[model samples]
Target: MKATILVAEDDRNLRRVLRAMLVREGYDVAEAPDGEAASAWLAERRADALITDIRMPKMDGLALFRHVRERHPDVPVIFITAYGTIGDAVEAIRSGAFDYISKPFDEAELLRVVGNAVRTSAVSVREGAGGEETGGWFGMVGCSPAWREIRKVIEKAAASPLSVMIMGETGTGKELVARAIHGISRRGKGPFIKINGAAIPPALWEAEVFGYEKGAFTGAVTSKPGRFELADEGTFFLDEIGDVPLSMQAKLLRVLQDRAFERVGGVKTLTADVRFICASNRDLRKETGKGRFREDLYYRVNGIPVHLPSLRARREDILPLADYFLARSCAEMGIAGRKLSRETAEILERYPWPGNIRELENAVGRAVALSEGEEITPPDLCIALADTEEEEATPEEMRFHESVRDHKRAIILRAIRKSGGSKTKAAEMLGLQPTYLSRLIRILKVEG
Candidate 1:
């Protein structure tokens, strides 16, 4: 069946053109002269996607977008705007519009955005009512006691409109918890904008968060909405919050307190009704005490504190998470599903995953790619299982030096095998000099 597209524009000629363009692409086209008529049409029927002009008679695209968000959350809305109103269109994107195109727009760009919207809408419908699968609890996959407690906190946090702070080690899924909070909240249908403090430079921090006018900087050719503005009536995730510069913390705090900020170079004050979800590997309280982070900002953003335990702490979740990753990897790689051998499963459960869930997922993906048999073995995982045994051994049962040598040998052998027995490639994989690897290979008596 052809996907249906609804075009809402006040200009009769432009609406007709849009209809023709959509029809040419083999899509069923519906036309509305203005937002009011579009809303009326939607009250009785459904369209796979919506395309509307930012400015329309009787009602505007923003109003229509809000209505669609509330009534038909699955349908993606695309905005058409003049160059002068690009900021408005960008704001709509922050408020959950799928995409936008400027006037004098290329027909190809419009069709491309429309095609994406239609496909995304169809996928959302197929996924279920909430438009996303929540795995077990809002897309988190775990049944451990720690996870159950975290779920309670997430449910309570989502019920309120307060800011959230998720604290965890680097790969313990802090961002996943932040997303779960947003997905289950009242702002679930709204945009979930995120920024990594560590990734953005200190020089561009202000403009990146608060936006700027076209002439604000050397490369600023056009006005752009910041993450906060885009996140209006939604959730804004601040990843690696501890990495935010001290100079910017006060500005962030002010926004959180007053919900108002001006563009970097412009004086017009903009306010966003956003719920902030912050995550950090560092403890903000310690940073505040060390004067590296502002105490006031810490207090403001840390309205609710939730901590995710490292994978090792929640050992029972390891096998389950590995299996989940295995199935997902198989599907993504377009390969037949494979199961973990009994020894491999035991090794995975016993391994202390220092890098946590993210590392485990990578390992599973690698195993899926490398495993040629119906079952993944310990060797296919490319992990030093000897280290796990060494850690579990009592001092009386095994000599520390012997265990260390064995662990090193196991790791070197695995790397060599994974590199197709090339010492140069194995050295690169092990982050060792080729001469060093050769020396170790001789000392450890590891032979192909």
Candidate 2:
């Protein structure tokens, strides 16, 4: 698929030259006279790739780059540098610029690097969203070891009535864990009520959970069932449970222990039969220690902890999850599923996803909305994630090791190709002292 690149360069002549070169390579080019114009353009429409000059007027490239890092963190930016300012070029890269090229680089190099950058960014954005729990039981998107362990935990949790506490980052799908727990529990046939702890008012929290009778307050018209009563004989998922206000924690603690509550205006107590499942993005232990959360309440709700791994923690699931989101999002957006190129998939694997799954879903949706072709190419993804809001990939990039293995294999094949199946010549050509190549070649199981 052809990519749309937003180009920002102060020099009109240089911009013309670059735009022409990119157009020839079959890319959709957007031109901006300066950084300010480029920023406005990005705000107006998400560009697939961004190319800007470092020394442009009215928002230099660096300043623009920082802005992108803040506003559109996913959009990857490249700095165009003259040959002498190699130091500045290097600095651009150091400061999170994808890559910079010397002024004299031919159109081929420009196209290749720009194409790579576009592909890398696009994939990152799409896969980054895979960390979310969009995929539940029927939606669980992977077969990774981490996910497999999670499944086992869910199965065990499902068979019992023990309260569950799920912990993970924002997009990691803590609620999905709650659902899985409900699906497996004996009360799986019953209603599953989900309430966001952070979404409720502190004052209304008790009433929301325990119900209130008529005249409970000025606005109370009649008695109403609370979430606990509604979820009786079933599961109740409390999301962002750590956000529960301190003043209300004591009352909540008592309800958990007593497994019953009396309506706000009624003296009669009502019993609850709901299976409690709590989800939190914070460390409950830390919160408990900090005196912000009740220690007794923590243990009560954490009878069985279901830990959801972050997207980055389960790298093997990235592409599969990305493809799933791609198809789902495309369908929702009234488009076709865009195919992923092998190279683009590799780029997805290379980056660390700090935002986890939710970020990935949003990126995929954004890509689908902005898709310009049948396939979701690397460039398409890059535009979605370029700029700054760049999610941090795991510090230990797995792809580097994968690349090393790939490069080593390529070198062996090249030596043999250059030697015309002559092991001795290949060994000598490869600079191996003697029969070392033969031994190495055998170990590698070279086809030739």
Candidate 3:
């Protein structure tokens, strides 16, 4: 794709000349008369490169550059100033400015300066500080193949402002995925607002997500900005989206479809110009088939369904992730870094991480807090694991007579839970048939 550039200058003639010259060179160019306009422009769309004059009314290039750096520090910036203000340009250079081109310079020189600045900026972005290759977002902190695939999908999804649904068991870092996508997307400069769709009551869902005008409903004392409005020009993350009532799902679908919504008791339609990223632990497809969720809405939200692999599927990453969190936990406590003994690492690998990555982080955190030494041993982790018996299960102890019955019964139970109590889904989750599942459930005396 051709590079898109933005020119921020107060002079109208300069803006016109720059636009004409850049367009002739086959570059997409946007013009802003001042930093205020430039900020608004950036808030709407992302640019490959930004060129601004240092001084302006309302807001200056330094302030705009600072904001851009804070939001998207990777975006290249070029500042133009007269020779007299070269000192200010020098300051900009120290603050991560792309490059500075003195005023009254040739058009060719300016073009080369901007082009080179953009190229260099992209290179530095990929090779982050300390000359290390940047992988995914900062919080992901895993080099596992499973994590790598998750990162690749998030990067691709962030390019567009489409809605994304991430489904995983609880404590799988669903929110981290949402934040990573938003942080890398064009809307990185916009606000990022998150809300849990499960905790709020059905009566408050509308007011919470779509806001409300004064006196819209009882206890609606004044106007309030909802999560959708607050996230305009940015990303809105809805956690536990499957928990939303079927009635509210229709409203969500309308806003997603039209990119617009209206506050309660308000006639005029307001636009929700933002990216929607929803996550849930429930099987939304099964929910729709069972008449508990809207079919259309399910299709809408699951446009790009990303299923995060459970921790057990990628057991190779357990030890490395545990060590990473162990170091972090020690630093947080102002204690010496803790090393996980090889024995401890082996134990961690054997325990099925039913709670996934979140559980691992917590396990390490608790170990660090409870242990007083620099080395975390197997005893430390074992004590931590024993506190939670959610993974408790017995071996296939039923000999000859009951062995067949016990194994089949366990499979049936797992499938039913995974399928949200639907016979068809249970069959699908376990790779069985509806008839087989029905027979097993009857024989096993399964309870819904």
Candidate 4:
């Protein structure tokens, strides 16, 4: 099928030029004089890709891009940028546009980017048709098997009425997983209340979880509902559940058992049909064994256990996640799209991310801030590899690692291609176990 490329440029001459370029590349071209026309065109027809100018008369490209993102997320949007609107274009890319090319762009470069956008759009459509969720499922960007399994668990847990307990290392996106469950569940439209068990003081735990009556304490100015009451018929996410004070565990267990609780100093008991979602970085089972956490409460909250793997275990997702973070940092800082240098990508993939996804995000954000040019290098990352008990690699060592990675990646790509994109067949061809081959592919970042 011929891919349709929509050209939305205000300038007629430029639109003609874009149309001609796309048509010559064998793409079916559609032209819109401005963003509004493009929006109207999209309302009735489907385009595989969109190329829009930043500044248009009615509904600017930024607004149009947002419209398309909400209405047609799979359609890749590219920006036709000028020197003056380069910042806006970068912001668009950060907001999830496919790509951008500055004015007076090389015809070849424009065609190459458009071709990529069209191919990506095709894949997205295929995945959507196949009932497979995209990488941006609930704002979690990952394609590794571990990530896919976590998502499956989330779907099952969200469908059930039982409480969900998410266990993971710190910075492994436990809260994010919790939120995803709530966001897709039957109670999705309801409020999602959250509290950190470790953040609240022991003395304030009851008031925070079960609220306080007027005149209950010295600072009680008025009656107020707590998180549980606030989250009635909704989901209450208790973060760091293992950190809940021992004294308060019994009260929590009672609430979980009965779904009824009394405000401080109040005789009347209130009931809330709230679903519970808890997360803990600490091992609650061990805590229970040590008598630090209540045994019954642990079982109550652990109705469904969802474990998020550390970032290092899902090496294939590193570069994709880095790109996600880079886009986010660029948007937050209002900077142009900055890429990771080849050497920097090698370093990121090799580093033992002790802090997990959060650490990687911070590293990317720091690099974005420290980077002066368009590329983020090792120095820009400023990561302390020595902290992982390994000396930082010299330039020669880094180059050697890159060379090895590239060679392995090439060989794996060849095997997969020869096997017609079957990893199992590819493993057979390579004379390696399928699981081990999958690991190597992930470690080498061979799959997009």
Top-TM-score structure, candidate number: 1
Candidate 1 worst ten-residue window by lDDT: 125-134
Off by over 4 Å in 2: 1-136, 386-448
| Every model's TM-score | 0.65, 0.57, 0.57, 0.59
Model 3: how far residue 397 lies from native, Å: 15
State residue 256's C-alpha deviation in candidate 1, in Å. Answer: 0.2
Least lDDT summed over 10 consecutive residues: which range in candidate 2? 125-134
Candidate 1 lands at a TM-score of 0.65
Query: Can you rank all candidates by lDDT, best first?
Result: 1, 4, 3, 2
TM-score (C-alpha) between model 2 and the true structure: 0.57
Whole-model lDDT for model 2 versus the true structure? 0.71
RMSD (Å) of each candidate, 1 decimal: 12.7, 21.1, 21.3, 19.5
Q: What digit string (tens of lDDT, one per residue) describes model 4 on residues 1-448?
A: 4788998989999988888888888999999988899999998778999999898998999999999987676688889887788768755553456667767677865875676677667544432111112246666889899988998999999999999998887777776687789889999887676666765667777976787786787545445466687778788888778878899999999999999999997899899999999988789899999999998999899999998889899999999999998987797578999999999999899988887886787678766855679998776664223223337888997885576566567666766887799998777555455887888877768964
Give the Å error, residue 76, model 2.
Answer: 36
CA error at residue 424 for candidate 3, angstroms: 44
Query: 1 or 2, which is superior by lDDT?
Result: 1
Best by lDDT: 1
Better of 1 and 3 by TM-score: 1
Residue ranges of candidate 1 with Cα displaced over 4 Å = 1-136, 384-448
Clashes of each: 1, 29, 0, 0
Collision pairs in model 3: none
